[model samples]
Target: MREPLFLIGNVNVDLVMGPQEPWPQPGTEVIVPESEFRVGGAAGNTALALDVLGVDYRLIASRGDDMLGRWLAEPFGARAEAWTVAEGATTVSVGIGHPDGERTFFTTTGHLHSFKLSDVLSQLEEAGDGRVALLVGPFVIPALLADYDELIAILRRRGYRVALDTGWPDGGWTAQVRTRVAAWVGHCQHVLVNDIEARGMTGADTVEAAAAIIRPLMPDGASLVIKCGPDGALAWRGNEHVAVPAPKVDVVDTIGAGDTFSAGYFASLVESSDLARAVTNGVTVASLAVSTRPRRYR
Candidate 1:
């Protein structure tokens, strides 16, 4: 039987606004388009995508004890276990989108920075055996990031299949950060990184070179997926490599597309254990996600 997936990461409320006529100068307001509030964060998006695909999974994350947190959890219902903190606000990301599909985000870390390893282990212990853990956005959780090595060791000892999506460190990939990230990748059974993240981590100019550098660090029989937006994705397992092209679509908003891809890829791998098919499914799902508006609570 396939193991159930457990997503561990940050959860936040996203206020996305877009297509303004011009940049707001000083106190003036510029509103030329649309706006919406939705759940945001790698783990939140991935868990929701898995829900849409009818995959059995659980979400373990931290949120502020506020209305936004409650709103965010409403979609997952019983499947979400969000540790609410009273001292701070829920993480919120305000995204400003341009007419050409580009967007910039202003984020407040809030409760996410306090998500600790102890909280994660408690959830994992209750998850039982034969489960896959997808740890997303370590960068956003400083407490968890500091204890990542020990956390991965504990998870491995408990027989969980570990996967990671490091999202992108704020200060770019410095030497120290790269070392730590490489160590985390070594402990994971699967890793998902975008083209820029791959290049930054490996100090390699091309995706192929970057993938080559990281592949050796991955555990034997594990897979590394490099997501290339528009172009497609590349999957590497041991000595074999497969490249799958993304389906072209009329893209609306790509806010959570990569997270959607991670969900599709890992869910398929849990079901089929075929890397090629998993990559194909990931691309297909990402295409669909980018073409539509962000998913809302059901």
Candidate 2:
């Protein structure tokens, strides 16, 4: 049987559209060839990817008590039983995809701020049953973010290995942001970030240098991995680095590529017990996700 796993963080609606060549000007409308509405957010995207990969995990997240919230929850089925419904509109992200697979997003905070430590603890029915809990989108969830240290301590006490993947902050990686992230990183056994985030968080130009800077701040046995889009991913663990190359494919969408990669990496790690294999699985899964129109996660 697969090990007990938990995916905790934001869950929201996503309106994806585009391929517009140039940035649109104010008061002008630019029509795109394609558009899609789907579940998104760091944990939301990961949950969807895990489902496609046939991985079992308990999802602990929140949604607003609105129509889109109801619409978003339908995709998770029974796994969303413990999800909290906050008294507000669901967070929605409008992702505009570029021709090169890069994308930009416009988002609303909505109900994400309603998730708290109590909700997380309450939903952990089988705490400590196995190992591995992924925490994502830290900045967006103020209630949970405020008690992040306490949350990690509780999870650690419950014998769950914590993995962190905080998506980019709205204000970018400022000094205060880096300092706060550093504090949290110390408690996590796994820290995953994309290439840009890695560099920005550490002020290091290269991923290797960034890992070098970040590893010292975390605990002794912690691992750090950087997702490098089409080039692939790299992981630093146990004083060594592992490189995983991504397979090339025609691009389709890149909105949740990082989130999907996180799911695949950890899932493969739990199953295979190999860092290289895990990173390989991550990039492979992400490549598949971005190359397909409907977005295949397997």
Candidate 3:
């Protein structure tokens, strides 16, 4: 039987510049560019990818009682068993980029600021009787991290395996956060990290070097995936490693590419529990995502 997957994270509105030049310095006026608002966020993007892969999964996250929130929620209502609209506005991210897809982000916390771990626990408790796997990352509320140890303990006790994606470290990473989350990774079954995140964790300059640094740190059963965009992705299990190139395709927006790959990998796991196949699926999906016009969330 296919196991049920659960994604817990942020859901936000994305404002993307259609055609923009380099950002001007403070007090320097820049030419206006086309823009569009769209549904995005790690939560929504991951869920959308899983949905597209025809996986049975539930997305648990907080949204606001505003238009952006509504737009984020509509797509998942059919598949989501329970979703909440907290008493605030949904988060928004302004992305400035060129036609070639190199971009920068300016974000506002908005409703995601109101997220509480208790709310997530309540939703999970309600989910009931199924193999629940969680794909977590850094874009989530800080409160979520604060409760992670407790949460992972509960999920493990409940017989659920956890997959972790330590999203980009902001304002630089400190030993304290790394120690706490590292301990948590020891308890996880899988970890999704890029060369950057791996380097942060182990202080290696390259992905291969970072992978070497990460290999011994992973728990007894954990698989650590090092995702290098376009170059390819490497899957590590114990002392073994395999590099799989991403499928060839025309480049577009890379936003949410990692999340989409996570979804595909997780979906493959739910279906077969075969690590190699899961990694291949991730590459396939990420290729599909990066080849599209502008941005493709799933």
Q: In lDDT terms, which candidate is top?
A: 2
User: Candidate 3 regions off by >4 Å?
Assistant: 25-34, 79-81, 126-132, 294-298
Q: Residue-wise lDDT of candidate 1 within 1-298, one digit each (tens)?
A: 2767888888788889987646789987675579988888988889888888878887888777777777878887876654545366788999898877778899997778778998787666644476788889888888888898998888888888888988899798999999999998998888999999999999999999998899889899889999998999999998779999987878788888789999889768777878899999899888888887655212
Extract clashing residue pairs from model 2. none
- Relative to the true structure, how large is the alpha-carbon lDDT of every model? 0.83, 0.86, 0.75
lDDT string, candidate 2, 34-126, tens digits: 899889888898998888787878899878899998898999999886788889899999988888877888988898878899988888854
Q: Candidate 1, after superposition: displacement of residue 111 in Å?
A: 1.3
Question: Which of 1 and 2 is ahead in lDDT?
Answer: 2
Query: By TM-score, is 1 or 3 better?
Result: 1
Q: How many residue pairs clash in each candidate at the backbone level?
A: 0, 0, 1
Q: Which ten residues in a row have the lowest lDDT in candidate 2?
A: 122-131
Q: Give me the overall lDDT of model 1.
A: 0.83
Output the TM-score of candidate 1. Answer: 0.94
